[model samples]
Target: MARTKIIAGNWKMNKTVAEATSLVEELKKELATFEAAAVVLCPPFTALVSVARLLQSAPRIQLGAQNLHPAPSGAFTGEISAAMLREAGCRFVIVGHSERRRYFGETDAFLREKLLAAVAAGLRPIFCVGEELPDRESGRWPAHLRSQLQGALSGLSVDALSQIVLAYEPVWAIGTGRNATPEQAEEAHALLRKELEALHGATVASKMPIQYGGSVTPRNAGELLAQPDVDGLLVGGASLDAGSFTSIVFAVQ
Candidate 1:
């Protein structure tokens, strides 16, 4: 079976509800023109309800959330829950993103609970795992990635695992106008596959999608997509622009 290429745009902290709707309107006009990767738009939580309402008429595009709180409900302050996202029309939620880890100090333990919450709420989890510049420079990134993958997803059922879309975003590359070459990205993706095989079986591991996230633009999209192991892209900056994001999506062809 061919894995569906997922092009998830993490519109982190950008765009108001109105701006998001306008962008989605632009995307709706053009997204259907390309039979490219499955397109997911992740606006800030504030825009989800509005964006979700718009997406009802434009079914080609999917809605996702940048993040979610682990609990269904509680006194978690200003955090939103997976159930709330579900009601807001989110089909997917990103967990363990480098930004969350770096800025908020989210740990693997917390991410595991978030993943479980997402799965329970019938939302797919886009689990982000990656290394920082220091880890890569020390040549310990593979080990770092493995620990994140295993340590976070250790006891998930096969069903829950299937709902996951793993995104590898090297901290050094994200939003820095730099990216891992196709070869380097492929190597990391291949290593992730190996790690999955060890945790699950080869059959299960082979079917999972491993997406690369970083400074992915139309210029490098085609080459990166051409690499056999790179199943999709968790796009950032380029995705903020409808034209550029569409170009990157078409590069999958």
Candidate 2:
């Protein structure tokens, strides 16, 4: 089966409820005639319900969460669980974003727990795995990616793995406006496919979507989307703007 191209916006900490409504309304209108790729908006937790309601009629657009806790119910103050996210009307959830892994000291093992929780709770997870500048500079990023993938996704069965999406957002590139080159993204994506095949099998690996999430802009979106191994994108800053985000989606088509 061919993998569908997905463009998921990771709206981290931005957009008030009213602002989010306006944005999604605009997207619903602008993209109403658009039906090329799978689109998702990951607004802040406070905006999930509002955005989800707005996107209900837009079948091509899906609602996603930025982060969630591993447990179903717990006293983990300030932490949102997968169940809560589902209740908020989210069909997808981002797991192991670099910001969370770096700032919150989330280990690979910890992310594995989160991925498991998200999957078990019926929300599909866009599992992020990538490396920082130092790792890339030392030419050890591939090894790091291998270890990360093994630690986080290897234990899952093929059925669960098939329901997941993999995102490669080089740590040094996420918000710096310096995205990896098309060749670079392809190289990383191809490596991820290899890893997935080893962990599961060729059939599961072939259909898994590997998204590129860094400093993606409409200017470079076309080139990146053209990569055979780059199945989609996990857009950040640029996704906040309706025009720019729309342009990126069109780039896929």
lDDT string, candidate 2, 1-253, tens digits: 4689999999999999999999999999989988778898999999999998888899889999999999889799999999999998999999999999989999999998998898888999999999999999999999999999998986887768878999999999988988899999999999999988888889988999999999999999999999999999999999999999999999988
Give candidate 1 misplaced runs (Cα > 4 Å): none
Task: Please give the clash total of every predicted structure, in order.
Answer: 0, 0
Clashing pairs in 1: none
lDDT of 2 at 7: 97
User: What is the C-alpha local distance difference test score of each model?
Assistant: 0.91, 0.93
Q: How accurate is candidate 1 locally (lDDT)?
A: 0.91
Give the Cα-based TM-score of candidate 2 against the true structure. Answer: 0.98
Residues 132-192 of candidate 1 have per-residue lDDT tens digits of 9999999999999999988898988899999999998999999999899999999999999
Q: Work out the TM-score per prediction.
A: 0.98, 0.98
Q: Each candidate's root-mean-square deviation in Å? A: 0.9, 0.9
